[model samples]
Target: MIAAMLKVMVLGVCRDRGALAMAFVLPPLIFVVFAAIFSGTSGTEMRLKVAVVDEVRSDETTRLMDAIANEPSLRMHALANQSQQSLREAVAYGNADVGLIIAGALTQDGEQSPIVIVADAGRSMAGPILSGHVQRLIASQLPGVALRRLIPSVDMLSGGLTSQQRAQLISSTDEMNTADNSKSITVGESGAGLFRMEVLDGRGNVTVSYYAGAVAVMFLLFSAMQGAASLIEERSSGIMDRLAVGAAGTDVVVASKFLFLTLQGLLQVGLIFVIAWIVYDVALLPHLMPWLATTVFASAAAAGLALFMASACTSRQQANTISSFLVLVASAVGGSMVPRFMMPPWLQDIGWLTPNAWAIEAYQGALWRGENTWALLTFLWPLALVAVVSLLCAFALSRYRLRLG
Candidate 1:
């Protein structure tokens, strides 16, 4: 029975890519995704780096930060400059996973003193999880004194109990604690601009932040490898020389491949986005212009990379072998396979050199965060580097052909 079941399962997986991916890939991926979502209250225990923005300077704030510092779920780090802009950069650059800002104070009925709590929702799960823990800890410690004083006294005569017994019971219970305030408002200030800042929201920021970097990087590698395949195919068929026999030299031949592969990359990204929209319900065009611009650059970068790889390789098999290793390795390091948040700090720092890492960041920023084109800064440098590399590859290809002895 076991042997038969194994055979059936293998056959089933072999029949379909989606089924195979779902069976072999989806389970672990799903587990990781769920883990990211509901890991624990003490996110510090998971080793997340958090930044503190303390707008309210009080004992309560101190206690909250202290509790956070002691937690294993987080590594509370900070930008030396402590400005909002600096904090945003820290989060964006992967130096910090969560950002906590103690915005202001709040006061309740008949209380002159303002009770301030944490106000930021964080870039990662640590933000909200840490905020919740901080709030609970602060409420438990600070509200204990006030609740104790506010316990009401009920008349023993009305309850048919002896006055002494009733008084004794009330004293014992009152000794525990009471809550002066009932409602638990998470934020201490207005919720306007805060929600908009997160990289991936359902509206597109979060998904874009994650997916854009993910897709651009992943597909760019694939496109380049595919472009390299053409070189092998051309050599196999003698197409390179037929075109090179005319004024359409190797330069023109390489240019055409670059242009064609870029178009293919653009189409692939478009299809992926469309499928994501229909399947995952990711918002496609929140800020249409920036989103469109991101797609264009991502396609261009992919093509340039493909051209460079193709021009350098000796044959399709060699290009395929080399490009495959490059793509998989780059994708692994650059956050195509796993979330960058979970990687070690040093590794995350290294991922910055990859185009996928930056492209995903920009796509996500534009798609989800309502970020302007400036978010594309992370992408532009990598893309520009590829273009320069491709041009150099073109020059090298000319030299290789001139001496193809």
Candidate 2:
């Protein structure tokens, strides 16, 4: 009886092709997906990739920039301009996440003063956390004008000048130095250019400003590939033939697949988030609005991806082989599995063209950019464009060929 039952079980499993595939593929797939998603920066808090545009060339700004750069909480990317727009654009284009705009006037003298912080509200991996650190550094360094005035007076008096006279003399000396070499002075403040970064690791752990691109790219690409799997199934089962028999037409069939794939995309996102929440303790509730915003793009991405798979192969086996290969290759290029920073400069340049790159960047925009839902309109609309393009292509294919595969 036991041998009969075992034989029956083996036959049932072999007969159910989908179940067989799922049983063999699902576990490893889930493991690889999550492993790629959550692997790294362990015990390290996410830092902002800040672009500091030092206009003043004062020792003060340099000190601040250097300090922030060295801070474990901020992976800084120094820029060439002080305007917020350029910094914001850097973040928007997936070049960097956060930035500092140091106006020339802000560091005219060797004074520890407040500088402009240009937070990329669209895709900062840790904007708030890094911003807080910046604020704290300023607060600690600059107590009050009256108080700071007293600490430095002891040195000025040694030069045999009164308080007002000493101030004038120091200012004059700094001006003269600037007139010689623009890079001669410290970056932002009046200190002699010596600076250090002080960051707390655990504090940054809750923030994750650094991992946005990594997670976004991996998961978005995963959704795309998974959605593409439906194409393989459709080709295998001969569903394309039955769809053409009705007046409902090819558009209807394609639309149904798109909708199905979109739903599947949502489920994939949900699964990743669930794993993240259960294990990594990343915030999902407070970030619900952004999550939804990301979901909008994911749906469109699913359509484009499914279309690609549907068109790429004539047989189910070929579709599976090509789709999986393309996904893995794209993910590698897009910085889904590895840090883009670690890859060669040319690879980084090429990565921008992949949808995986865009999705990752957009996700970063939502997760760490600290903007509300309304801000996502600009970030999300391109994904919809891709979706529309995919649907149009698939519709055209169906109209011309009357069947996919």
**Candidate 2 residue lDDT tens string, 21-132:** 6567655775664354334322233344667776676665665566576677556665555556666666554566555666644323354434554443333234445556
- lDDT for model 1 comes to 0.59
Using Cα atoms with residue i matched to residue i, what is each candidate's TM-score against the true structure? 0.63, 0.55
- Indicate which candidate wins on lDDT: 1
Backbone clash numbers for all candidates listed:
24, 17
What C-alpha RMSD separates each model from the true structure? 9.5, 10.6
Q: Which ten residues in a row have the lowest lDDT in candidate 2?
A: 195-204
Question: How would you encode candidate 1's per-residue C-alpha lDDT over 1-405 as one tens digit per residue?
Answer: 999999998897798555565567656765654454334222332466787766566654565567677865557786787676776666655557766665543212232233222222224554555555555544454443233222222232255657676567556533432333454333232221122234322363354446644866697668757865676576557676676677776677677766777677777777787777667666675666676667767667777777677667666655665566567656766677666666655556677876666677666666655567766666666766766677567657754864582
Model 2 residue 175 CA deviation in Å:
19
Reference-based TM-score, model 2: 0.55
Worst 10 residues of 1 by lDDT: 187-196
**What's the lDDT for residue 11 in model 2?**
90
